[model samples]
Target: MSAGHTAVTTPQPRPVPVEEPVIRCETPQDECGVRDLLDRLGDKWSVYVLVELAAGVLRFKELQRRIPGPVSQRMLTLTVRRLERDGLVSRTVYPTVPPQVEYELTEMGHSMTHLVKALSDWSIAHRPAISDARRAYDEAHPA
Candidate 1:
């Protein structure tokens, strides 16, 4: 109790609402298109390419070297071509005594890295549980 003194209340900030994403298949064409894209992005080599490109711009050989395992030149070329065709990657060619080419992610490709990283984190976190489940399933269905 003070002489003519009053307490003022502070305004509380509202929390941002989170919305669930919706993927609609209003037409057969839409479903087919989604599946086609999923197949392209979900293939064995594409994700590896994306992860490596996330580091920085790289030449074709550098990209090939960075990716682990015995990946064929043909396969890598095909993967990059597909990514570029999808507008997720850009290819630059420089002409000189010998031709030079470099590959980098487009804006769409950069945005997709977030989803890729999330998937990678999820796989790492759940690997142990997945291994346990596989082991249990194998034991139960011994043949």
Candidate 2:
């Protein structure tokens, strides 16, 4: 190359633009809504009841049977009532020789099933890792 001459190099191609997911910040109202929801559905029994009801309509006894652990009838009743109040479940009464009552998910409740199922799936998938972490923490902390 001549001392006064400079070689020209080709410019590199620009990177293709990729779309990023939109992120939303929760407002104060959103926080209140979340807190209210957590207050209503915070208990294990409520979550279990919702999960069972996600399948289909069920009678009180049937719901109890479907749940894995021991949940008292009174607790189940309360959970259902709370869910009903939250507009997450609907209760139907049929008049017969004896009155029959059934509980099923409302449209809003159905909408939440995917989220609940995803939570359950995540819990199941991470259970081993969580257990390992707990064990490690316990050992490290000696408590």
- Best candidate according to TM-score: 1
Top-lDDT candidate index: 1
Extract clashing residue pairs from model 1. none
RMSD of each candidate relative to the true structure? 15.2, 10.7
Give the alpha carbon lDDT tens digit for every residue of 30-65 in model 2: 563567767766787878888899889999899999
- Alpha-carbon deviation at 125 in model 2, angstroms: 2.3
Report the lDDT tens digits of candidate 1 across residue range 24-103.
67777668467766876778799999999988899999999999998899999999999999888899999965789999
Question: Where is the poorest 10-residue window by lDDT in model 1?
Answer: 2-11
In model 2, the runs with Cα more than 4 Å from the true position are: 1-32
Q: Could you tell me how far off, in angstroms, the CA of residue 104 lies in candidate 2 after the best superposition?
A: 0.7
